[model samples]
Target chain A: MTTSDSSPTVRTPLYNLHVELGAKMVPFAGYDMPVSYPLGVLGEHNHTREKAGLFDVSHMGQAYLTGPDHDTCAAALEALVPGAVLTLGKGRIRYTQLLNSDGGIIDDLMVTRLVDDEDDGRLFLVVNAGCKHGDYAHIAAHLPAGIHLEPIEDRALVALQGPGAAEMFATICPEASEMGFMTAIRTDINGVDCWISRCGYTGEDGYEISVPEPQAEEFARLLLAHEAVEAIGLGARDSLRLESGLCLYGHDIDTTTSPVEADLMFSIAKRRREEGGFPGYGRVRSEIENGPKRIRVGIVPQTRAPAREGTEIQSNGETVGVITSGGFGPTYGGPIAMGYVSPEFSSPGCEVDLIVRGKTMPAKIAAMPFVEQRYYRKPKV
Target chain B: MSNIKYTEDHEYIRVDGDIATVGITDFAQSQLGDVVFVELPEVGASFEQGEDAAVVESVKAASEIYAPVSGEIVEVNTALEDEPTGVNSDPMGNGWFMKIKLSKASELDELMDEDAYKALVASQS
Candidate 1:
């Protein structure tokens, strides 16, 4: 194995900034990312939960799908996904999946009807880091003639996540404080124009800001200047999302797993499920009505040792499922994981054993968000 | 205080009579990051020099702790079962991984001493 050449690891605009702060650079998703700073993963995880942690997610793909009008674009997107795109209100983002014809999930992505420019017909999308190349190709090939796919490789995505993240942003962009969960605004941040969205994978009341690549270093520097802001990495990112019950692309949801099997039915609007017309509509609607054969659920280890990815799940000495993601959830103060299991043993209280190093460790099927989600929302007046 | 001996796989051994204490060097722990779990050997397990003895698990990856010298497992560090970060926080002192009853005292000559080990780590880094 060759160690990464520090000079040629596909430097993002903030590459030098990360090095200056003493980040442990590791190759991830085709880019050199700071897996942790001098504080280490445990410190970074606890920092994100207690205060705020700034993540340089510039490697993740951001794109815009444009068409003649709202109906036109929504129609174009609905043809590729199973979610009801038309129902998404301006400024609202929906967590949905891209599906193959056979009902397998191509990727799980976030789609938003651009807050102020919905009439002109553009849907903003944030895709996974590992699946961006394939997702872009898949979208470009399937889009209608008038609809165009624009990959925003020249942008930087920063996630400011924690309980104090909203307050930290309120100082820079007061309007951000009013943006409820899943809402977003395209506005100037610290005098540099950017988009601030009230959403994150960490399950905290935070924001994901999209800034021009050139201004990424400046934006990251400003955020780190805040007393509460620290830099986090892919290690903590995985741990945080796992604790939040969020599904990661290429793991929890994949080319062989449908949204129904992943227990993401909440993402499918009532109208979309009732009147199926999206891609993989027939199979997905059928699975929704007649429950999926296997469902994704949470597993809590009875022992301190974690059941990591690829661990076999068994019931009564019979193999029933496989663990997709698992590890120590620093925030929950114990080990937590998510995996697909037979529908018969998918209940929250069902008992199963995770085969760790050939030993059967007792585990229980538990409700997700192993910890409570802490998303910010508007106060009802 | 005890004189430390280094193994090729990065583990450090300190032998005093028949009992030998084992731990990873500071350089090794720094590279491993914050260790989350340590699977120590069961007391009385026999192993040859260079055999897989214990297992150290960091948040990012898992690595095998090799036997620096052949011996009978005498006492494993039970505290590391719940506090693996001790390996990172104090690798040489409280973080010692295991103790073994040395089968051959001459094996110590095969390991590097403090001055030679320092030179080795510096050359690698």
Candidate 2:
């Protein structure tokens, strides 16, 4: 594995805390992040699925787009991404992709519209750590002069995820339990100001708390003090997101992969699709109507051998696709993977071979989310 | 007790006459973190020293186990097929990966004793 020895690595606010907790540090996205703790990857993964896990996701990029009004700010952002940002409800969040001129994804991100009585337009955005600099530069270059893209460098993000997350957060801040999925609220947790969003990458009902840098460690410690919570590392974070079938920015959905081919068509709102004004509207619209040539799909090895990234996928001796994100799923008790394949071989149950270390391992195309998602959506009244 | 020797790659060999028991050390298992699968060479297969003789996979990645000395595989660890975590729990005992019939007993002279191997591990760390 690659070590953080080549360049000076950046540390998050919880760097000392991770070391005190016995985290094995590794280089990830230009940061010295913890890969796993003393519990090991398997134990940490299982614990997150069964209970609550606190993740220090401070390496992610956080920023805000501000303007005179919501329409101005939303329209400025809509020019870059294909999502219907103009109509995004107040206090609501939307998953979107920043696309290149050719309809290829630059980065996938989360955009949340905050509720403000003054109507001073502001939208919060969270981008991948590796692509943050590029994403910020792209936004600044394309947005109108009146609109400003402000990077929130003084804040840290932490995610409390898994089955018991809602209950644990409710104890500290009761209002958190009332927020529906894909919604955000500015709340105070034990007097620490935070922006808590009711969403996560783990396909579980959870909250992502954006807190000030100075109070980040203290806030994390408070939540970790709960009986159901354990401090998770990047190793388990990867497996949890894989089991949820969520794409990692650079790995699964990169500049070479279009949003449609990446199976993120739902992120394109109806109005945006009909209007077609986004950067890659021409290619994205065509792909939406005619379907993409290649699509992302889930793959499960028929054997115990795990097919890792860069492993070639084949069908009857012909190389068809390649594994992008793969590993052993602790919950599934087997090797699970996601990759891009030709449309002909993308259906669930289609058999293929994963070339691992010059050996062909049997695998089959399966419907994504090898694990069932349990996002909490408030029942309609 | 049988005479024990070590390889730089973190494998250990316990010799009793011409027969030898081979397995990875505790340090190797700890670095691997939770062994999930092990692929052993078939009995009767022969390999030269430093040749890839087996494969061990942890949750994170896979690694090849090299032969410490020229030998013919005599017995393979079948229990690892179902319980690979034994390699982590009892790396030197029940986790013994295989047994081999040494082609040349004199090969042990080139291997490290416990003291030298410990020094090497310390230096690497």
Global lDDT of model 1: 0.88
Query: What's the true lDDT of residue A120 in model 2?
Result: 50
Lowest lDDT sum, 10 consecutive residues, model 1 chain A, at A1-10
Model 2 stretches astray by more than 4 angstroms: A1-5
lDDT per residue, candidate 2, A76-121, as tens digits? 9999999989989999999999999998899999999996666459
Best by DockQ: 2
Native contact recovery (fnat) for each candidate is 0.36, 0.59
Query: DockQ for all models, in order?
Result: 0.61, 0.72
Please list the residue runs of candidate 1 whose C-alpha ends up more than 4 Å from where it truly belongs after superposition: A1-8, B104-106
Model 1 misses residue B93 by how many Å? 0.8
Q: Cα lDDT for residue A123, model 2?
A: 95
